[model samples]
Target: MAAVTMRLSEIGQQLRAFRLESGMRADEIAARLGVSRAALYRYEKGEVIKLDTVQRLAELLKVSPLTLLGIGVEYYSRPIGFFERIRQIEEETDQILQIADPVAYLVTSPDYDRVLFQAIAETQDAASGEQYASIMAARKSAYETRRPTMITMLPEQAVERFLLRGVCEAASPSPELRDAARRVAAAEISRIVEMIEAEPIGLQFSVVSEVDNTANCMLMRGRERMVLAINPFRADTSPAASTGVSLITSAPEAVNAHQRVIEALWKDSLKGKEAADRLRLLLAEYAIR
Candidate 1:
């Protein structure tokens, strides 16, 4: 019975993930499933789910039955869904192994959110403002409360581009807004330098030379499972990004491979005072440009 409950709980988590990816409301799904909304929420809360119901849900959510059974890949085309899923994973994560250019969203400066919201507002509809804000707040709150150990690898070239282009990637911007964006970018880099110098516990940041054909991904190590998310949607770089599909999987081989790659990169990457000094020099050289 205990084993069955645990399996059911995992299936519930997968159901929630794919449901968000499906972009279908609870009531809508309930109506289509011929079940009460309360019942649908109960399933998400880990109640025993019938096999027939699982088949119906797989059909409605456009995912294979094996996926809901927690044995298949989870694909997300919507950035909102992907980010929300990330938040869910991070909630239970013990540590995060991340490889992204510039910096990961969790380590970004506080002001980064405002700049990001503005850029997203410029590119996205006003209807999505509330949802975006909620997700942003939830992510920040989860990180603050959990404080998971994070090891991030950032590329030097990406940091250079961040300083050169600033945070706002909107198509057209007023001169004053552009200046403000650049200032924020410089401040963010400064914050990163400070972090590198401080060498805080449970937080590791390394800067590596730019390499060709690298993917943005993160591995979240949890108490029971390790999940890898290969994401192309970057809020810091491009707020209105919607072209790429993010892949989330718990396959051991996939997780092991990414972990190995991160270890290899960390071995040759610059860290501590050396990384701080390099970033400071980049800041000075790029501040004038």
Candidate 2:
């Protein structure tokens, strides 16, 4: 199941590459296909490329269907293309607005200790010392070359739980394994906060009862915006699973609709000092200290 999902994701990446090489704009492709630009954008994002669209893209790119689908080769044998696209987006984005409910660290500038924090927070049993160390090293390397203009909206309850559990405390762990996890989480959270404070970025928080109701993150870039809506529980259970149904489109109307939704949410959100105060209040309520 993992291999299949990975292959499909790779194919999406290859399709995007070919589209770039062919010098075809998404709008041009959409016009040719008699669909909205947004629909074509969805195809590129690997949001369920239809069989017919796959055939058409193969015909257009001059690649065989099997090669594009990545069927005959090892799945991990190829590089993950979506990561490269993410890197490209980070480099090119003038601004980023991230809404994270369950976790707050994935898109932070100075990087978050995603693996260690996730492991500790999700498990009652401690991780191995080696596992904790390896995740920290990987986290450091991943953040070395990329930085994005970021605005993050996090739910209050998630933050409260994170702090109350001492997820960010250096003393939370006793054994070597738990200690390593604790240290990593504390360091990474501090680093991220510092980076955000030093940059011309925005970090906000709110108590949105509707946050969990919405099941995806929205990335806006220039005139192009990508909406990634995934079922969280399903995704957590199967980390490598493809988004069952993702809608990626560059149609002006669709993009406008998403933008409007984002704007409305932002307007209702707390930013700057207000956001910090709210966070402090929540932390106090949870007795984080």
Candidate 3:
């Protein structure tokens, strides 16, 4: 019963999002569906919905039945408070295991917050990106405050690319800003380097040469939740300003599958001294560029 209720709520949220995305007002949608505005409101509020009504709603919203069903995962489209959502999940989760892209986020480096502020400050697009910047700042605060355990996978080649050229639109920051960002990025990786040399508890770091980046995912062990984030934006791209998508689910089967994938990737990843050596090689190359 509880699972059904949860699924219903997820579906409702997705329906509302799709409707909004379609730019169809509730009255318009309700009238087309041969329902009153109150009935339409009930549908979006996760009230019991019939299959036929769902199909009709799908047609009205120009979405598939599966999309309206919340069949496998709950989808979020450039969610307004995306970082806040993650922050909420993080507070509940005791540990996070992430399969990241080259420039993975949620870093625990001592100087990361400073770098973040500088990047936001130096960027001309900050005003246009205010909502993203604010949410990102809040997310950072939440993580720093909660200090949840995290295992992060960093791709050696990707880090090299990141150091040489910032991700997405961040590629063209002022030389001073770029250089500052580079030094911070290098230092952040170096701290990971030190961690590789000196293994730490509660936090684990790995660098892989072979890209196991089939999908970027976060497994929140505490919340029994897994986040499948298909971000079209790069690491430097603010998720809030980007058109990427994220799906979250507390379904045990999905979580288990994600955990298995993370474990396999972790096993294949380079760790400790070997990973440290890889970072050194990259840094040496970066020194010239």
Worst 10 residues of 2 by lDDT: 73-82
Give the higher-TM-score candidate: 1 or 2.
1
Highest lDDT among the candidates is held by which one? 1
lDDT, model 1 = 0.79
Clashing pairs in 2: 38-249, 38-250, 38-251, 42-248
Question: Pick by TM-score: which candidate is best?
Answer: 1
Clashes of each: 0, 4, 0
Given candidate 2, what's the lDDT at residue 9? Answer: 73
Task: Give per-model CA RMSD.
Answer: 2.6, 12.6, 5.6
TM-score of each: 0.88, 0.47, 0.67
Q: How do the residues 158-186 of candidate 1 rate in per-residue lDDT, one tens digit apiece?
A: 78888887875543556666676778888
Write one digit per residue (lDDT tens) for candidate 3, span 151-269: 88776667877666543335355677667667776776666778767776677888867773456677776643455433334445543343666676666777788788789889998
lDDT of 1 at 279: 88
Candidate 2 error regions (>4 Å): 1-92, 102-147, 161-212, 223-238, 241-247, 287-289
